[model samples]
Target chain A: MKKKRALALLLTTVMGLGLLTGCGGSGSSSESADSKDAEEGKTLSMMCIGTTADAYMEGYQSIIDSFNENNEFGVTVDAEFVSNSDYKTKLTTLMASDSEPDIIFTWELGYLQTFVDGGKIVDLTPYLEEDTAWKDSFNDGMLDQLTYDGKVYGIPTQECVGTMYYNKAIFEENGVAVPTTYEEYRQVCDTLVANGVTPVALASTPDDAWLVSQYIQQLANGIGGYEYFESLKDGTGKWNDDTMVQAAKLFQEEVEAGYYEDGFTGVSGTEAEALFQSGQTAMYYNGSWETSNLDNSEYCEVSEDVSCFTMPAVDAENAYISMGSVDSSYAVSTNCKNVDAAVGLLKYWTNAENASMLLYDYGRMPSTKVELDQSKLSSLCIDVIARFEEQKSLTPWFDRVDTNIGNEFNNCGVSISNGEDPQGIYDGLQEYAQSQS
Target chain B: MKSVFGNKKSIAVFVLPAFIVYAIFCLFPIGYNIYMSFFDTNLMEKSTFVGLNNYIQLAKDATFIKSLKNNILMVIGSLIAHMPLAMFFANAIFKKIKGAAFFQTVFFLPSVICGVAVGLTWTFIYNGNYGLLNAFLGAIGLENLQQVWLSNKNLALFCIIIVVMWQFVGYHMIIQLAAMRNIDSSYYEAASIDGATGWQQFVNITLPMIKPILKIDAVLIITGSLKYFDLIAVMTGGGPNHATEVMSTYMYYQGFNILKYGYSSAIGVVLLLLCAGSVVLSNKVFKTDDTQM
Candidate 1:
């Protein structure tokens, strides 16, 4: 009896300790989350990219806090700031577990399409039709990227165009000007290299493959227009097509010419950004989403001199089209308990006041149709706005349009950079595309 | 009947909680995973049975094959390091150098540090710009040899293997050392009087005595290397076109990155089989005598 009692007590103690640890971990996570969601009657969870150290968090948190206090739903909002690279992995894991946030930060196209097709996301078409003001507030066809078979699954919060963020100070020191065409861009790179500056900063890690691919995508758009992206999607345009081959060949030649920083294949996105910001490189080719990063005094020693330009058209007849897409999007999960509160938060975020705040302070382009108060825009942002207004057309980013195709293309870019034959890279992509169908 | 009931009651009390925990955590997941592997389920959606399609497709997956090759390379590398090299260290330490205890602690320290920290430290040491390896090369007038060690596809897996070998050699060494320490000193003392050299005694007595421990070590080295995740993940992230990808990392990529849960589960089942096969093979190789002879 005594031995049995001892064993039983021992098992009980072990079980009790295990339960205590489990509760403790969850309790701490919840405690840290409490201050973010403290409203009495309503609460919504918002997920976004970047760590706490990022300045974008400050602007995003303020927007959430203001939404919580002033919204009619009286719902407080909690913002979970996942690091940019880790966010997609975490979101996919959460989605798989059916534990996705009420409103998740998502990308458009094939990314959200999986959720939409899986029926894990609520159809927002009814919500849009119910509110004319909400429906009309967005730019025409802005929501199309988030649509699948005529059903809207998300609302894009910002518009991003891949542009060449250049250091004006570097250009002035080198006695060169910003290039506006394929030939001029090449000449600019050649000149920058002669003057001892890496002409472009590009990180080629698989995660940052999108960065390299976007430049090629933009070049492809200039060479063959948006139809190339669609044709590639439909399996009609092979990755080894003349236009793609030309773009790959050009990028390779430039890389060989020392256009990018030395050992860039080994560098990460943060390191590349740092190199550009510190004036080691003459240009940083990235999306407008990085505008906030460029404008930050800490990241850039020459913040005031940092500016951007669209990659010039490779073929003048096609004109310089850009690779762009709606930025971070908001989606309501099927499991959302309060649909109205979620939509209200989305509606509130896209309102002119918040849109303007996002644009002016963070350099995030607004998806809404609201006219920007030019006086409220920074000079760096004003230039990007002008470039966006002047573009002949905009093709949604390849990755956002087709996730599988986009990832393969990005991998192809890395392979091409590593001196792999363009034909081999394209053949691999063609094989992958065939398998997808 | 009473004896059986007595045994049953004691067994029930002792095994009930463990059985319940195992069923909930392990058996349930295995069953669910097998079911899941037959479907196109994305976790949020209704699944449609695809039968053996995931496995059939995996046969043609070049990336998966590459990952399998990487896992095999890791297993071989670990076997070499953990078996012979670790045993050599164990024997040396068991003979009791002046500071054998101190050296054992020093050697085993790296294994105790979390894999993430070790990976991070090695990453810094292998960094392109300011790495210790590059600095050493430069110091020795081999500046031309300073390539980005982790980022180079050809060299990345080898670099990871070196770290794996370093981290766990000490762990296996300690295991073998403990077994060596357990052998009675009477045999060694008698062998020494009979004109046996240290190497001869080690071959005659130590090797025979530690066969069981060697079997256990072989099983551990094989399984541990096959499922190794943290160091590889924290270091290169199986990148530069999946150059250093192992089955475990590729499994994660398929399930998490691509959202192909069925395909990922198929990979998981393959890994389980590989581990089980290795254990049985090791047992066969190290089969012991039935008699005390």
Candidate 2:
């Protein structure tokens, strides 16, 4: 009886300790991911946003592998990637806790500004000034979003503009050409609908609300021009601006016209993308980032027939003010052990050799200009690149402009998709924005 | 050994470690969260102390108000489904209804399945296009009834409540069933000898006997409903413009999504208060007699 009692007590104690350990697991999540055979000072932790599921992970990994093998910093750049959906929340948690990795994949403007204001990011102006060649390599106005108080804190690796991808076979079957004006775009969609085709594939779920907002903002860009966006970015504008209202009305009209796939508000971004990739829909309006997905025959059912054009402007004068911005921008955290090595990694990633390799192998558009090799480019990529070059003005996503307000704006887009009155929704947004501040 | 288990020093030694663990993980965080609620903080910048302004702001915040209403509705829904419905099932099972074991296992099965997995299964069932529910409606010539169940703000909360009902009814049934089983065979035999009907015996004997367990169960149901998060998070993410937003999800949105940790903490404090308030109210409502079987 004594021996049995002792054994029971021992078992209970072990189980109790196990329970405590299980519950305490949250504390050890930030334990460093080790680099094989690399000593303490030789490894730098980096966090990028992608998962192995993404097609571009291959291109991203190749860049990281090359950097690890050959970078001048002699540091092994170990990267951990969270999926796109979880990236913002994870980064915010890390930022709040001050446990952010050395380098982070960041959105350009307001997203990075939150960290900059918190003094959580390293100011990269001095490094940029030291490497004039690397500084000049980036396209004009690309670094402007990352600049705050005359200090640039982040650098762009890729530029992406929203483009309307279409199925060439479906267009030809319906005898419709790529639309060049808003009227023509409407007519093309009208024709597709008349021919029993779902004109566009769009997702409006809350998780994919940005997809809807980007579309509406694209329409707003065409109608309101660059100045309207500038006004909104600066505090002279409101969410209920007449231009925004008009743009939203136009979007609703399109929704009523049966120009989008049925039950789009219930569709996820991936499901909407799949509709276009599988040739279930004629048009897909999304970022240039989707080029690689469309370029590959294995992923895209209409690979040979996929082509893109910028959605035509509502008022021709505001032609090139597009839903476009620098994507996959990298920022060094104040927590970085070695700023030099981090900046060196950033430079190596954006440099011409790797940039062109990514563009050629994957469809990532470079922030730096690289001489195009026509033989290596897919037709779809070439079309997207041409549409990208035609953009005379670009508006970064509203969420990227101000993370909190931008998020609410995305929610407003969801409201619009659900057939809510745009005027009332925008009014509510204005009230929300005021309440937040 | 001088009755070793009765020794105070040994008991304290065993409990101290667990108490410390609980204090660090639970008590400290709750205290810190309550402390943070008075400030307007992003958790990164220097936080400003606004002294109840966070709670004050929550009153005017439409989304938070909507979430609070949703939480109340969820609690009511859970009470209706888990209490009487579970009692009915438990009573039937206690009567040894045919296939009682199989039905009991089937009913208890969903609670064991993770919330995320259940949520995903229901999402597919609720999917607007090609969902099982829509297809069934169509097959029955009710095509007009087909709508995006989750995306429609009006129906979304109720739909999720139905899921909450489905997932936990069995577990609650088992709890009530256990209480029902604990009733002595003698009471029913006595009641049977007295020519009492089954319903009469249950009303006087079974109910009074299980009042204590039922009281505990009511508290569990109410508090669980108040703190519910996962299903809402997984299914719609408190969305279609947060129509289904509950307190816990709204707290997450404020803290993690927008980085308004102070406002989020205020929501957490409200949820905690609601849970505690419900527990006390439930205790009052379920006054137990010393009617042990």
Candidate 3:
């Protein structure tokens, strides 16, 4: 019995030591491995949004691989890809922990502004100012969204605008032409519904609230124009503004009119996209980033017949005004050991050759000027590019403008989709906005 | 060795490691969270002391209030399903019913699955379009009854609660069954000889004997429901305009999504208090003394 007690005591001590060693070993080994990598050469870590589901992931990987192989600075990059849905939470957690990757994929405006406020991002203004040609390469105002307090914090890689993608075969079968006016858009929906087809495929799940909210913003853009969007951004406009109310009412009307697929409020983004791809819905309104997905034969049964046009203007005078913003921007984190190498890698990524490749092959619209080879682009990409060029103004999504108000707007959008009273919803949002200010 | 067992120093040696770990990972976080509840911060930036403002705001915050109500409903729903219903199944199984082992495994299987996996399976089953529930309804000529289970704000929380009930009823049943098995068979045999019906035997011999375990199971069900997160997070994500938002998910939304860490911490403190309160309340309700066992 005494021996058994001694054995048990010995086991307990061993277990305690094992736990202590387990904790200490992991920390020390990782530190050593990082130092070893640093001594070999600068190793920049990049985290971007890309997963197997995204068509352009290959293009993104190729850019990283090429940069790693050919950079003149002897810097190597280790990249990690997270799916878009999980990117924001993952990035924010990393930022909070001060272990953010050297380079991070970021959205413009308020999303990046939070990190800037936290002093977690590297200021890229000096780098941009030092290279006049590179600065000039980006279109005017492209960098403005990422500029905070006169310092640029990110490099914009692509420009995106929302467009209404439709199945040509479905439209033709129903004898409906692409709508060019707000009235025509409603009529088109009516016609589709009368023909026993779902008019639009939309996802309204809480996780995909932005998918529905962006379309509502597009409608608001048509009704209130870019000026209204700007006023909302600067706090001069109320969420309950007449045009905003009209936009919400119209969206609700559309939802009630069976303009959207059945039970769309529960549908996930991918599921809604699949519904349209499978030829069950006539239209899908989303960012041009979806061009590759819509046109990919592997994912879409209607890929060959997929085409797009901008949603028609609510007021014809404000025609071509759309909801859009800079997409796929990269920012250097303050945690980066080699800022220059990271910036150089970003520059290489947005260079003319890679920009053209991304645009032609993956349907990413380059923020920088690149010669378009029309022959190499999908027809949908060409149409989207043409629409981008024709846009009178593009308003960014509300969530990108201000995280607090934008999130409220998205929640309101979900409620609106579920047949809630728009006046009550907007009143609550307006009250919250005022309270925040 | 006997002296070592009686010695406080040896006992401390055995307990200190686990106690230290618990303090670091659990107690410290709880204390830090309470301290954080008094500040307005994103945690990365310097925090401003906000006193009781976060708690005050939580009271007025419509979504938070809704979540509190949802959480209460969840607790009630869980209690109703896990107690009497579980006891009924446990008693049935304890009588050596036919196919007892098969039924036992069938009932307990869901609780063994990961919460996220169960949530995902139920999500597919409750899907609005191609979901099994709707398809089944349609096949029965009740197509009009079909509605998006997770999207209908009125039905969404109840649907999730049903899944939670389905997932854990068997688990509670197993707990109650174990307690039933611990009861002396001689008591039941004596009651039978005294001409007591099965119901009488259950009330006199079974329930009183198992009261101590029931007290534990009650606390588990109540506290478990109060702190529920994974299934709700994986299912609706407090969707359809925050109709399904629970306190835990709201805390996550505030802290992670909106970067309101202080406010999230306040929510955390409230949840912690509520969970602790439920345990106390359950203990009082059960009132089974240790000596009774």
Best model number under TM-score: 2
lDDT score, candidate 2: 0.88
Model 3: C-alpha RMSD to truth?
A: 4.4
Tens-digit lDDT track of model 3 for B27-115: 77778889999999986778899999999989988889999999999999999999999999999999989999999999999988988
**What docking grade applies to model 1?**
acceptable
Give TM-scores for every candidate, taking all chains together and pairing residue i with residue i.
Answer: 0.93, 0.95, 0.94
Ranking by lDDT: 2, 3, 1
RMSD values, in order shown:
4.8, 3.6, 4.4
Where is the poorest 10-residue window by lDDT in model 3 chain A? A22-31
Cα error of candidate 2 at position B156, Å: 0.9
- After superposition, the stretches of candidate 1 with alpha carbons farther than 4 Å from their true spots are A1-41, B1-6, B290-293
Tens-digit lDDT track of model 1 for A1-437: 45335534644553454333222210111223443343332566768887744667788888888887887776777778998778877888888876677789889988899888888899999999999898899987799989889988999988888788999888998898888778998999899899887888889765677777787777788888778877876668777788888888778888899998877776778888888888888899888888988887866677888999988888887675787878879899886767888899889889998888888888888899877788988889999987788777778776666776676677777667667777777777778777877
What value does the lDDT take at residue A289 in candidate 1?
85
Off by over 4 Å in 2: A1-28, A32-39, B1-6, B291-293
Docking class of 2: acceptable
Give the per-residue lDDT of model 3 (tens digit) for A107-183: 99999999999988999999988998999999879999999999999999999999999999999999999988999
Better of 1 and 2 by lDDT: 2
Query: Best candidate, DockQ-wise?
Result: 2
State the weakest 10-residue window (summed lDDT) of model 1 chain A: A21-30
